[model samples]
Target chain A: MALAEPPLGRTTAPTRPAPQKVWVERIPPIWWVLGLFLLTLPAYANDFILFQVFGWTFILGMIALSLMFLAGYGGMVSLIQMSVAAMAGYMVAIFGTSGIAAISMDLPWWLYIPIAILIAAIFGTIVGALAVRTEGIYTIMITLAIAAAFFYFTRQNYTIFNGYTGFNLVVPPQLFGIDWRQPVPFYYLTLGWAAISYGVVIYVSRAPFGLALQGIRDNPRRMAALGFNVTAHRVAAYTFASVIAALAGILLVWQNAQIAPGTAGIPAVIDILVIAVIGGIGRPIGPFVGALIYVLLRTFSPDVLLTFGLSGERFKLLIGLGFLALVFFSPDGVLGLWDRWRARQARRGDPLTGEKGE
Target chain B: MKAFVTRHPTWSLIIGFVVAVLLWLIFAPWTEGMEDVLGRKRVFLNAIFGGVTLGALYFLVASGFTLIFGLMRNVNLAHGSLYLLGGYIGFEVSERTGSWLLAFPVVFVVVALLGLVLQNQVFRRMEGEELRQTMVTIGLSVVLADIMLWIWGGQSYTIFAPDWLSGPMTLPIVSGYRSSGEAVMLKYPAVRMAILFAAIVVGVAMWLILNRSRLGMLIRAGVDDREMLAASGVRIQYVFLAVFGFGAGLAGMAGIVGGTFQSLSPGEDTRFLLASLVVVIVGGMGSIPGAAIGALVIGLAEQLGLVYAPTYSVVFTFLIMAAVLAFRPQGLLGRA
Candidate 1:
């Protein structure tokens, strides 16, 4: 990972395209290059490849980003972010149109989006209030319970949730004479939202609230002694994190044009956790990279295995093994490996050049 | 009110239950048809029976959960995997031998050995580091469950009891607890009775083992002060490892037992794991007696809740756990 870093003034020759080291790190040209490459994918890639693989990957990555932000920064591993996202999805279905044979409110896009997000954030805060009291594993148990409870409530309560078959037919609105559900539009929409989400995480990790959360994660009692309202900060972190997840939830519903119990089930919820951890919970970009790997494996593994005379279900086995290996070897994930690799190359290069190391 | 209830929870619970029972008895006669056909009193009795049996099964699972926590403080999320693995293995054995009775011992040994390897390979390395331990176990569980799926073919399977304990045991009861005290004949499954009996035996055996046996003394000493035990030249690490394996073996045995009680499926691992978590919360993390009591409460509440409020049966488990945690963060029998 460290090997990928720009070794600018070293004896090893560097590529001319390296951006000038600035006082404040500018948005690197590489991001724009990558973004442009992705933006142009719809030209070559089919609708199935664009929407299900790349677009869905971006949305899942966004949801995982929320979990990464909390666990990576706040040190609180919560399991209710999926439930919080489900709340938004359900809200969208209730406030807007759905497949359920009922009178839908069919609220406008602008109105329902904010209201759904607002309700989701409020729901997150309420859950966070209950969860923030406990420490470590207990917190995980509580959030899991709450998520399970919500799943049951939604599944059994037919009147509101439309029973086990959750609401479907939640399509993206044609706000500017363009069907957002179309492959190109959807892909760009997902990419744009992902970039925004990524930026938000990066920005928030440097903010006072984010730093305070990390402090609490390190030692809540010490932080409390320093006059920080530990629970409040933790709860607030949950709210912010939930908002991010809710946005992803809404996007997920839009991507599939439906929401069901399976969308927020235990396995699905755990998958988000897996993605975050696999991506390396240490940095903002980890989830997206992990999502890319996950999406590739998820989308193609079945077909790939088929060519090798293996059954389709082996993909789950592969995913589980992949997760286990990643956690066991590099807890910091792909990003950590990259960092280590870069640091290694830099070390080796320094000695070869006889450069005095720090 | 909260403070008073928290301080005097046991007494308050007893009083509340008595009042609720009396109220149910008074109002039961007014309701007729399907809801009251068995007689509300009889339904309550049946629910209690179901709860007791289910709770016994829960006890079997949670005891192992509690023991591991008590000794190593490692929450083996993969414990559930051992359970299903044992059941699946036991099923294969029983299917081959045409005798379900012989599967229990086989399951116990296999699962125990598996646990020993897991402890040595995974838990031993991440000793006392709860987070990584949890991650490793989660990984193990996912891998194991998938492997089971690959082999078991994702089809649900049930383990059957031997012919001796296969049939239901009919009981005749004359009751006066209700307004109109009448004679009632109830048919309860013998398998349930066996489970309850097994739970009692296991409970007593664990108590005796922990109290009377030298190994138990070492375990107790290890729990109380590992530093002291180690300082005194005892290889306490092996004891913990053995205890972990033993707990795992119990899980495997419970899997076979639970399989007979209910069908086994891939996802059943997580369900049992969740049940064990709820049991741990209510029973106090490391207390065997606490596990027993918690299991009964959860089992009864689940059965009764399914009858009374069918939609909320699953919710009751967490609801009870949440209530216990909210009122007593240390749990009912857990020490602060």
Candidate 2:
């Protein structure tokens, strides 16, 4: 049941007596190229590409990353990350301003943002508390049921949730004399958060807490016998993941300029799971890869479908089929495929020195 | 039951008190004060009946899900799709043939066949991989849901009960006294009552087969220890296939029941899926009687909450689930 990834091991240099310590030299050229391209994308890319596609990808990636944090590291495949995000979205709409004047308090951003994240984190913690009571597969079922409950509750209760219509015009605040919701600003906003989320998750994965969580994932009884509080670690992982999801939710609301119960609907919740699984939950970077693929498919599948004389609405069908194919062929998703390919290539000897490829 | 009562005397007393109060509420004619406090007796009675009938439907859907999960350890997320597919098929059959009874077996067989194919082809390939199987089912459900929507569209469909089951039947229980002191008995939809009766019959039959029959014994043994069952020379795959087909068929039939009680639409699949999940969670996964009890509690909570507190009815169901998970993670009747 403990689907552990390969151990993170550091490689020693063969030619040099001492390992190099330059951080920049340590970073691969591919990362520098990718980072440079992303950083300068707003300069040339259209508003749609910068705002809608990449922004959506980063937001979704962050949420899915939270799920990966749990499923990949904690071995708890929670479907509640989307709901937590939606809860933050709803809290922002309620505490700050929205089209629903009667409901919105119109608080300052400084006040509402913290409050929203806090509330969402609390909600996630409570759900995590309830969910962690069970083990393994039950986690999925319980979280899904809880997620459905949240959706239904939001749809039903009008006083706070504003009923089915939800809140509109829930745009981000204009900060530092700049409209953050603008394409360029929003792109950077989401990208910054996505990077922070990615970095935090990566860093924490190696931290003692994260290592302990992973240990608990592999063997809870053993962890417990070793004096680690298994339940507390699991719950803490949820809280950390929820903060990431809540941040993503706020950014998502700003990106969409509205919030609704459908934001956390069963389909949406399931979509987050699909995104995490399709990308590969084995690594922190996997969710972003999956989200990018998902966003591309979602954004462009309509035209592709239309070319085949099919309706645009068949995008879901396409996604479903693609998902099914991935599940059947590559259970670990695109990342798994990449890993296997890398493994195969590494087995091949280098042409010049006849040495095995790294 | 006697041993349980003796083992937990306090719990037995509390349960006894609650049951006695509920019986009194049902049988004893409400006074004017009582009516003023708790609304009309008819409304209360209707809510009770509504809850019970709804519970019947929940039990039908959830029992199959529990059985499949209990034995196969395959969390078939596509189960809800099977239910909806059955309902659509049932609707199509009943509509074309003009015979409500004719739809049941046809829908059951179709859905059951689909279940067999899935078990044989899809799940068998990923044996012992519970998470992967679940993911596949999730994928299957998404595909099935879209395909169903493509065919049925977004409009809701309700199946009509036959003439024999259509009108409301007056029960002996007095709802209220008329101005002239004449007793006004309770009148409930006959179709609902009949469906409730059918559900009860189905439940009893399943319990009987599981408890009394050899096949049931084999299934139970498999549930307890699959490796042992297979080692004993039984064709465990066939047993798995049969159980899966039966569970899927039962779910499909429940879809028809649900359509009759309410209506079927695209979202109903997810709705019923969540319902079954909550029922299984509360009742204990793989326990039929647990499903029944869980369904009953949830159904009652939903109906009663809807009547008394419209906004928070969902909270009641959720609270019940939360309480169960907190107190007994295995569920109310689940084994530790």
Candidate 3:
């Protein structure tokens, strides 16, 4: 089950039927209009909403994509992915030109980013090495313990992490004398990084390593017998995911203008898990869609509830109810449902394929 | 005798403890005024006491988690939510009735009923699907926590115990050295002692029920081979419901004791959940003695770490987990 080896060399050969021709005809014109409307939303949306809501969502969604890589493809449900990202973010703040004993002593941007990303990847590798031994719930628990350990350490140690306040040391540097924090600039920056990450993820999902990882997921014993080295693949997946998360971490610090323990604590970690599942674990685009929904909900729910004579904190109740409903009704999440509907329409339009009369 | 010693594990445990105590005594300072200033003697006693009390809470919660894991093979992530909900229910009940005794049992029963309903309605539908169950339970946990937040608000609450248990009491043990070479008196919290007693009783009862009863026999059999039991016409679903309810009830009991020991906050649910998960993982799942040992080790480590390395207390727990996982992947009491 080596994931039907990626059609790499045959990319231009048309070895298989094009997926678009099979499914695109079934989608209604209204759906196309809806897609167009969404694509044009940034132009109409307010700056406050764009910068605060959409910007934050993109950053968080990228982090969730890292977790989605592990849980959906690698069959490793970890709770420490955010902690790893936070670790990297904290490192940037420590190494950048703000802390008392900055690691870089004002090192150049090129040197700092690579060092932070490397450290995060190494940390993720160690966590994966420890985690790959256990399966199922044990992996979750171990990762959680690691995250909890990091959270407590960051909260208490003042010298390195700047204690509870964390490091408010770093902000996105001005490139070519342009302040990147502006809504449109920051949005583009985030969107560019997200697109790069999504591209890499899609490529990896079709790569040989990804195929082997999927084989391990489907049946580890069988894969192990076939000399696939399941544990190594899992650790590699984690390392790869950590690289993506570290990139997101850099963007996150830029978005927030600070790195605090709260950024990487248990709640934030769980929120990433929730975002990944909500977006739909089946595809990379799921994180973006889920993030959009979450960001909208979080931003508007409080104000909406306040208008309805309810306290803003009560908005969590609504979110919780919505999450449970989503899990119960659509375990594959919104994307899964959308895919099913599209397939159904495609089949209906083509009676031959629908009725097995082809 | 050598064979007997090797076969019976208790002999090795006794030997280990004796050697550990001897090492501690040889290393521990015994000078006048040193104990008074550093309070090392009292600290040791306090740490042990804290460990045991915390271990009791861990036992209550982890036992349920392990039981559910053993019987249903489903990691009930919502177990912590049930514990938190139990605390909130007890808090509300006590506030309304002005009676702690009535509040405790009422909360337990209510949570048990909730557990039963959840098993019948939600978990039963998710049989044989571990990942789906995880998501559903996690969703349930989030929903429950949010509902609790809405109902209880974000303020931390403390339960009031009886007057006698509220204050610290001086114990008869006089083991510390004063400046003038006299023994100094030490005080311990009476509530902690009470919790320890409750934990021991619960442990003993669980041991007896799990080892000596017919229901326990069926549970053990089912855990070993659910398909076999199903083929044999045994009602596995009923057993699952019972196990789930009982585990939830145990968590409720732990919550009441924990609320009294530590203040109840909205966030304590996840904290305790993590602690319980750590315990069950370190301890062998489905093994009562394993839970007890795991809880004690974690409890002591946490207390000692808090005293010595407050910043790295959680690291000690993780270290233990990593070590255990590296060497004994099935846990101390788990069958290989």
Candidate 4:
């Protein structure tokens, strides 16, 4: 836990032996139990606890999960994931009437859903096209710039994006006569989608394409020599990740009934990065866990800080400190810490992270 | 002139001609209020003054950024936070000592020490690991930003220039149909002029150090081939440390220069960082001359853009960057 002492970068890479067995990866029984427990939480918890706390965490987690999918498996960092999400949210608001009549065309809700997701996917692909050619720092800078561009565009373009005020009062449409925004219904809707997306990410990482991506991440030139199309794979990864983020964006709009410029702002984008990173980038579950912690800190930090006679803005200070600590101590993330704890318990002296020791 | 133009038309003449025409096209229309000659002249002069001063400040930040990044291949995203720290410290120091000049060295020394700790602790540990370096530095910046917010409050602050530089001064150059004997000199803020002068000094000093000195050769060599440079027995780590400190020091210097004129806010750190990125992207990273050109272009575009389209001033820089990236990804001066 004393990551400060370890003088990081002691090694070049976090190597672990790839898990070879297939049968061991079956949907674990604990997942079913955890899923069931999560499903039932809405029944016991009140509206605020169910919707605001859990619902917000799950929605934000979905965005972070999309990031994790790219960063963990595809070996790309797309800061535009949140932008894609916000785009979907904005699309829904524009196509359907929620608020900002100046921009809203007031089309049917169903028509906009696919269009939003498709646009986001296309946008993601375009961003990836611009980004994938550059390695490392260039890739990060380009994506960040694109995200910033989107934020500025949305904030300044009044006719379409409604400027900084953005669109408000966006509620989920009724289907089958059940109000989707209702606490239990909303929670179930979010949970069901989150699970499917999580499953997709897990499945893809084990898929041949995902393996190819990982190979490219390790050495794109070698992968290219081996006949893999590195750019295409990277672009495909962005497209897929964007679709996931877009869906979460739709859900995000419904949860807040509002979508604003701040939703796609750099700080918000960076927050998603922090969540994905703090949760653990190595596995699928890390984002949700990270999101849960982030939500708790954000929701409760006001009361927590008030006791210490500190302003709520200082909550950001705590979050920043927590992020720095997490990065230094467990670069792999909270899930990485969990794995290390598990490895310690097993007493096998196994390497705690991805790459197996030589 | 003809021989020079014929010899290097593509590299020198065409680019220069294009830039000149573009500037004329953008600024020519501002003379619409020529009927009020004084007003038109003042506006034109202010735009030029503002653009150059902003560019100079940007150069200070980007020069440091390009140096650290080029030499070590490390991206210290917290460079902006270092700038903010310097400004805030400068703000504090200037307030305490009642002498604004004292803030410069105090900030330089403090930020350099902080940079030393950061390099040894964070950057050193993550050599060659760009992703980890980015994440750690980002995290460090976030922490630093939040801490500053806590100590200085969340609102924006504008540091006043010391009395000498606070007021506007009349320039020798005049505009419109000024009478030969009249004091029709263009009035400009002394602070901005000082900053422009400082930026030029830093720029010239950096050029001399990089192009003329043995250490400059080593640093350039390090940027070109770190392994080869180190294999030749130079302590590359020391070079990285020194450059990192110098870069941080430059950020601090910009913070002081900028804080005195432009407003300093909590969010300024990210804005400055992004501006530097655009600078580096336009100017080839690791090339000092490249950064200067990039900053001037971006700064002028930002000011002109503000005049033409107030809401989209920032977007103009990104457009420039996007255009550059599309045509020349290595940057205008960056070696392919």
Candidate 5:
């Protein structure tokens, strides 16, 4: 898609309006089928599949989507998204009711949710301000350090964070006389939020703000020369990404029924990056696809390892090797591999790839 | 130094005052008033030594990190994994050979060879692609960590110092007054002091080599301008290989030092990686002296914070990093 092209050159020059198209015709049939499949999967899927697999995928996808928004579009590979998400999760447990009555304020859902997002957003903005001070690769290093600090602080501070053993039994509130924690309900809940976030990202990608961000990513100097506030745009991108991450975090806590330091630990932070990269950081849909792969591997790798006469704990090794291979062979991840294959198929009528002339 | 003083006279004065106070606290025997205001002189002395020694270890790890980044522009995130790997290998070597000193050369060779392979094979393929190289390192660290865990298991391992270095050595500093009017000398672990001395030697030798030697000139030139260096007919690949291998080797050796003082575990890789990252950030990227000063600051902050404010020690370290980042994004010693 040549995302690096500046979107400001061909701006609204007060010319005649472009032709309008029907919204229904814009979407391909494949998307409609995929959407329908996802929406109706709970009807036949088991409770385990509904609650654990798909629910976890959507939550992780949303978080990774936030990462893609920054890295793919804004050219900032931030490792702090997981930390921000964890902050939101922790805020929910702290502000809303939780297992620890002494620390948690026991506020209502409506009050605490917004407060959680707000606090997490501010935290992300501060991190963003600090990070945007540096350029390119420094962003990853700075964000990783800050993320580690957040983890360590959360683990050490017993007053507010409750220390090592964090909040537990933090289920979603029953808003409409329905248990949101149930497999079916949770599946639908995560699906709705994930769909909304995905839509938001897709919508924003073509918007002026997103275009400016892409332009800045390509050449900050040029963007600044064009009278854009480079730092402000970058920091604002973090704020926007943080909101998405925070929302995912809230859902993540509800899914787990707990929140702990491990949720946003170094490994977990890296895992988000892995998901985004492996899925393909070039597009918003990549994170969701990557999340699904990660969730499936995480859920099923243990059994697969045992079957191979290896310890189930070797799933990390498997994931590591796979990631290494992917980075080596296809830097843009699975999506890149798919893209090349499609391009090759388009070049020739290949029976092996099952492609005909377009 | 004169230029720095002239450039920021106020900063120089504040720094001079701080240094003066620190010297007084370290050298002068605390009176009752001083002892009351601060805790005991012995505790303060111990923290100072501890922090300095810890800083030495950090310098060992971070110097390599900075050097690698400086020469190759490769952010070797797996540098910590190299450290942990070296620790594990050092443990095995010492355990089998029954000689702690033998582990250094062996681990250095093995890990440095691994570094050579990574540079020549992996990173060289994706030259100039900074983000891809970083991703590969992250993946490498993960794979190496898991492999180490698979082989070493989840248990922690601590390499024992040789017999001569194991026991406590007394220093000339006055710890306190005895009831019979005798001065109580301060005693600390002999191994830590020896390690500290070794680190100083290494740091000095590296500085001398980099600043004074032809090889260092090549490296410095490469850092300043790789394309120019290459155009000058220098085999820049060899420079990259040597720096990467040497840095990896240094990190491996630091693993032995860390394993000697602190136990090596699965998560130590990440901890030390973060330490190196923070150190480089605070010290300034690709600057050896910066790494040293940053390490000292962070190490001191950590130990002192641990001693006085146990809960908020991490906070203090984080605050220093934040302040440095806020003020000088290039780092304390980094070139813009």
Candidate 6:
């Protein structure tokens, strides 16, 4: 059951060339307006909205971006990506100069952050090593088992993870004496990290490893026949994705000023998957778009519904309906539809006029 | 039977059984000088019984999961949601009609019909698109869980059983001797025994249905090769529908049984979903006997770990799963 390749000798330039570059050049006008709006709104928005909702959304978007790299590019769908981040978050809290035992032991941020990322990366490697042998749903289940096991261990092991209450880790020291927790400071910090992560993801997506991974995604057998060590590449992809998630995890702990099992457990893990899918899979900007939608729904839907006398819990129902609708209508996600529309318009244009007009 | 026994050597079987028993003995809490402690031995035995009952419930749900995956090659991630929805439906029906028996079958039928409709409408439309189907099912699961939360509050609810089944039975086993020179006593719950019976019946029925019936033959053929079976003039869609409904109905039945064993909460959907996924992976997807073995391993590991290493019980299962996958990904009794 391999799919047949499209026949060669099809017209390559007539319907495609100009608009492909045009769409690439034409940045959506809405983004500029939206950016300006966001730049101005922080001054007027409440501290809670700016710090908690926006900050957490950015952090979550960062984590979802890591999963997107694997699932969208490598065809490796995993459920334990959140667990890797959670592990990093927990390590930060455990090793940081906070929690119950912190009076006896403390580590500087420089030393602690690297150690946490290393620990999370090693954990991800081990999981990937075990999971790479399976295909499709088996891979998903194995990751889920790993995640569930971690959740249970963290929930019950109080001496180590501080038990169910979790650890109240100290926030990162403000740069140049700026109060990071202040709404504007935190939002900017989150946005800066998000931008860096997004840029790295885009760069990686176009790199040789990304192309090879996409090759494996399209046809693993062919890639293997072409001398690519498929398993090794998969493990490498997972490790890189894990590092990305770990960065987000560190940021998450910093934003919340704490790390709990609940942050990385099944519900939160599944929510990340929801966010990725809602935004669009395999697209560079999907995670950011999805995060915006999710954060807005999570933040405002409760108050919006409460005004109509409905309970806040009904917000989940709305979110659930929205998710279903998105999946039904746009399986490739919003970005996919946008790309398709541009392609359609390019196919409809007069190809000969392009060079003549130029 | 004699020929079969002779051809299949019993050495591996005997060794496996002995090892399992030794592991149980080593991990059993009652052996840790706990007989003298008041109610410690009782609690230990109760936990074992609880574990076994829970294993049966897992088998019930995973049986359906494996069957669906085997027949259609679609991993119904929403199976847990269907189970949760079934529990809520059963809860509502039982509350309205004041009859638990009516609620049981009614919930099963409703969920079965729901599965049929979903298969026809959503899954069928996305046939051959495995990833899309998976995502859509996940979306549906989230929607169902949210809707269920809206209808039934997130607080846990207990399913009431009759007085006869609810009470405990005193089984006078040599539950070990106390340091104070008294015989330890253990009272197992009657509900657990009832669950054991249900497991046995379901297991046997599953065997007979898959091996002895015409419909079972068609299902087996479908799993082996759907296109060939269709080429043979059999309508594969009807078989897929039947298998899908049967699988979902099994999940509903499990919900009814599990609701009595554990508190049914909105969160249990995700917990059970994860558990089902683990079972399928460890047992090898689509194998009934494999599901049974996987459930037993997970259930026993969890129970024993809770007794000896409570802090690491959850991690223990994952470690076992990892080891199993590393060494024997096909799982016990599963085809490679």
Task: List candidate 2 segments past 4 Å from native.
Answer: A1-16, A350-358
| Residue B70, candidate 1: C-alpha displacement in angstroms | 2.7
Off by over 4 Å in 6: A1-49, A99-104, A307-309, A343-358, B1-44, B96-98, B170-172, B177-186
DockQ for every model comes to 0.55, 0.88, 0.63, 0.50, 0.90, 0.68
Task: Kindly provide the TM-score of model 3 when superposed on the true structure, using C-alpha atoms.
Answer: 0.90
Please report how far candidate 3 places residue A50 from its true position, in Å. 2.8
Best by TM-score: 2
Q: What are the models' TM-scores? A: 0.90, 0.97, 0.90, 0.90, 0.96, 0.88
| Chain B TM, per prediction | 0.88, 0.99, 0.91, 0.91, 0.99, 0.89
True A-B contacts kept by model 5: 0.91
Per-residue lDDT over B1-336 for candidate 5, one digit per residue giving the tens place of the 0 to 100 score? 899899999999999999999988887777889889889999999999999999999999999999999888889999999999999999999999999999999999999999999999999999999999999999999999999999999999999999999999998888888779888999999999999999999999999999999999999999999999999999999999999999999999999999999999999999999999999999999999999999999999999998889999999989999999999989998988
Residue B7 lDDT (model 1): 93
TM-score of chain A of each: 0.89, 0.94, 0.85, 0.88, 0.93, 0.85
Task: For candidate 1, give the docking quality class from DockQ.
Answer: medium
Clashing pairs in 2: none
What lDDT is reached at residue B64 by model 6?
A: 90
Model 6: clashing residue pairs? none
Candidate 2 lDDT over A101-215, as tens digits, reads: 9999999999999999999999999999999988778999999999999999999999889889999999988889999988999999999999999999999999999999999
Residue-wise lDDT of candidate 3 within A2-112, one digit each (tens)? 578886766767767656654578868986896676456679988887788878887888898998889888889888889888978887887776545544356677777
Clashing pairs in 1: A1-A338, A1-A341, A1-A342, A2-A338, A2-A341, A2-A342, A2-A343, A3-A341, A3-A342, B283-B290
True contacts kept of each: 0.50, 0.84, 0.67, 0.53, 0.91, 0.81
Q: Rank the candidates by DockQ, best first.
A: 5, 2, 6, 3, 1, 4
Better of 3 and 5 by DockQ: 5
Error of 6 at A135 (Å): 1.8
Better of 2 and 6 by lDDT: 2
Worst 10 residues of 4 chain B by lDDT: B26-35
Model 2 chain B lowest lDDT segment of ten: B327-336
Give the per-residue lDDT of model 2 (tens digit) for B1-336: 898899999999998999899889999999989989999999999899999999999999999999999999989899899999999999999999999999999999999999999999999999899999999999999999999999999999999999889999998898999999999999999999998999999999999999999999999999999999999999999999999999999999998998987999998999999999999999999999999999999999999999999899999999999999999999988898
Best DockQ goes to which candidate?
A: 5
Worst 10 residues of 4 chain A by lDDT: A349-358
